[model samples]
Target: MKLYTHPDCEKHEMPGHPERPDRLRAVMQRLSESGMLDDINVELAEEISDETLAMVHPPDYIEAIKAAEPEEGLINVDPDTYMNNGSTRAAKLAAGACLQAVQDVLCGEEKRVFCATRPPGHHAELASAMGFCLFNNIAMAADYALRDERINRVAIVDFDVHHCNGTVDIFKERPEVMVCSSFQDNYYPNRYLDYTNEHMINLPMAPGSKGGEWRKRVEREWLGKLEDYKPDLLLISAGFDAHKDDPLAQIEFDESDYEWITQQLLNIAEKHCAARLISTMEGGYDLNALADCAEQHVRALI
Candidate 1:
């Protein structure tokens, strides 16, 4: 497995932000302390090209985000998301990390890759930016995997606290891409699970649902979708915010739950997609839970 990250991810953080530097710090520290950090090849992600980003996001929106960078004070794009001086580089590296993971996995250099970077994607849309995301990194990776690698039928399985509304919107009509999400319903940006596309399988869990309930949805809904789709590649929007310890969301899940879900996904990927998997970091607020759950997710890759 390949590990993609950048120190710049730590730089773009807003002070006292839920998606702060300590989140990455705790995750990296846990991997190192658990004697797992040295087991994989660590690659500093390169900058993604403009053309690559434009495949998923509009050029004007990209330029607007770049222009929104503040050299001095925070520029609040919304009540929850803002930009500091470091946001541009951090966003670049975040998108680049997923892009690199896709390239490496498709080239046979690595069968699976984990992008441990920040400013999480999933909430980001084609022409809008919100939810602390400046760019939809995994969305760009999906486009790259389909277009550049010439691989058809890709799928994104998201288990975030909130739904991947942006991903569903982008690929709703595109049969080649399947989107499965297990997120809290009636949460921010409201719910858009009404899309007519059967490929977009959304299992909306109520707030405060436990890991067992979440896992059952994965087994029943997502796994069935995975079996039927038989995707050429499996992409995971790996978010750990639903952990009981997470400050931002209400759900009960531990590291073992993360391990179980990853193993399940990996099993399907192994059977159908040549084990070509790219997992990208999304939301996880509580540092300890995020770090621990992320390590568990990584253990399956190892």
Candidate 2:
């Protein structure tokens, strides 16, 4: 497995915020402590080009975001999202890491990849940012893969505690890409509840639900959908916030849940896509919980 990340992500964080840089720090520290970091191939993230970002975000919106970056204090992009001096670059690099992961896996450079990036992108929309996100990294990566003539289909599975409203919004009308997201029903950015699309699988887990509920739902819903889709590559919007120890959400999943889901995904990927899989970071607030869950997930990946 190949790991893509950057320390610059820590430069763009909000002070005392749940989505602070320490989240990635904890993840890396734990991976190192567990001896997983040294065993894997670690690469520095590259900044995505404007053309690549424009594939998901509008040109004007991109320009506006670049202009919105503050030199000194923090700037609020939404009710819960903020930007510091390094936010724009961090967001771009996060998305870039996903894009590079896709290309690397598809070209056989690596069969499996884990992107430990920040400012989780699942909530960022085509023209706006929200839920502590800027650019939709997984969405853009999926878009980039679909743009390649050699790749016909891709599957994106999001196990974040919150719904990946941005991803759903981007590909709701597109049938070539299959998007399956399992999130807490009563959580943030509650739009698209009424959406009904053949290619989109939205599983809303009730708050306080445990791993058994999640596992059952994935086997019943996601597995069937993935079997039918038969994607050329698998992408994951991995969020450890569902762990029982998380402070931002009510879901009660633990590290074991992360390992279980990863194993299931790996099985599917190996069967259909030559084991090509890329898992990207999304949400997870509790430092200890995030580190532990990330370690288990990476252990499963390797």
Candidate 3:
């Protein structure tokens, strides 16, 4: 397993916000204290180029995001999203980390990779930034991976409390990519909650759903589709916000739930994709819960 992150990821912050820099700080601190970092390959993520970002986002939208960055104070992009001086670079690096992970896993340099960057991207759309996301990081990485002829099919599994509307929007018509998202029903970014297809699996659990409910639904809805698709690579939008302690939602999951889901994905990866999996951080607000869940996810990856 390998870990990719950048210091700039910690620079994109808004005071008193749930998506604050301390989120990453807490996860990193826990990983270090648990000696998990010592067991994995850690690399600083580079900023993604505009050319690559353009694969998912329009060029003008890219320029607009660049222009929206404030020099002195934070600028609001939406009700839940903000931009600061370091926001652009942080978003770039966050996306870049996933891109690099794609390259590394495909080239056989690593089997599993975890990107512990912030400003999660599962909510960002092709031409808009929302839900604290500036770019669709995993979507861009998936598009980048498909460039390699060897990777014909890719599966993206998102277990976030909120829906990965941006990911579903980008790849809804692309048959080559399969998106399986399990999120809280009637939740934030409510777009595409009712959308589903042969390649897109939207599993929406009711509010107050427990880990067992999530597991049964996933096993019934996701596992068989994943096996049938037989993806060449697996990507995870690993969000821990579904935890019982998270303030933003009403789900009851703990670190063990994360571990269980990771193992399930790992089994599929090992059977079909040479264990090639790249997981990037998404929504997880409670600092301690985020740290503990993230650590367990990484430990399972290891």
Candidate 4:
């Protein structure tokens, strides 16, 4: 498995925010402590260019994000989102990591990749930044992957506690891209929770839902559709926020659940996509749970 991250990602944080730098630090520290990084191919993520980012975001919106970056302190983008001096570059690097991972996977340089970058992107819309996301990293990478003639179909599986409203906003009209998201019911960024098309699959779990119920729903709702779609590439918005220990939501997922989900996605990738899969970091609040869940997810990918 290939792992992509950058120090800049840890630089984007606020003092009292739940989505702070310690989240990334804890995950990375756990991987290092467990010697997992030693076995994986680790690469420093680079910044994505504005032109490429424009595939999913408009030029004006991109410019606005850059312009909103504060010189020293945090500036509020939304009620739950903030940006500091390092945020712009960190967000770009995070998005760039996904782009690089997609390119490498499609080019056959790697079969599976996990991007451990931050400023989670599943909630950022086409022209707005919210839910602690500046750019829709997975969406941008999917758009970038579709640029290649060989990749006609793409599937994004999101298991974040919150729905990927931004991803749905960007790809809802495009039938070639199928988005399967399992998130908590009545969660944050509550757009598209009930919206579904031929390609967009939304699985909203109840507040106290556990891994068993989630797995059952996945088998019933996602697996068949994924097999039928036969995507050329598979991308995952890997989020650990649904874990029971997480403070952000009420879902009762654990490390085992993350591993099981990863294994299922890997099976789909191997069968339909030639194992071409890339997962980008989304949300996971509690440090210990995030670290444990991320390690399990990567172990399954490996």
List TM-score per model, in order.
0.97, 0.98, 0.99, 0.99
User: What would the per-residue lDDT of candidate 4 be over residues 86-183, giving only the tens digit for each residue?
Assistant: 99999999999999998899888999999999989999999989999999999989999999999999999999999999999999999999999999
- Given candidate 3, what's the lDDT at residue 122? 95
Off by over 4 Å in 2: none
For residues 1-302, write the lDDT of model 3, one tens digit per residue.
89999888999988998999999999999999999998999999999999989989999999999999999899999898999999999999999999999999989999999999988999998898999889999998899999999999999999999999999989999999999998899878989999999999999888888998888888998999999999999999999999999999998988899999999999999999988999999999999999999989999999
Model 4, C-alpha of 232: deviation from truth (Å)? 0.5
Candidate 1 global lDDT = 0.85
Sort by lDDT, best first: what order? 4, 3, 2, 1
Indicate the TM-score of model 2. 0.98
- Checking candidate 4 for backbone clashes, the offending pairs are none
Candidate 2, 1-302: lDDT as tens digits? 89999989888878888999999999999998888877899999999999889988999999999999999899999999999999999999999999999989878899999999897899998898999999999999999998888778889999988888899889898888898988888678887755658898988888889999889989998898898888988999998898999998899998999999999999999999889999999999999999999999999999
- Name every residue pair that clashes in candidate 2: none
Q: Is candidate 1 or candidate 4 better by lDDT?
A: 4
Cα lDDT of model 2 overall?
Answer: 0.91
lDDT of 1 by residue, 194-282 (tens): 55467888888787788888887788777977898999899999999889998877778777998999999899899999999999999
lDDT value, residue 103 of candidate 1:
81
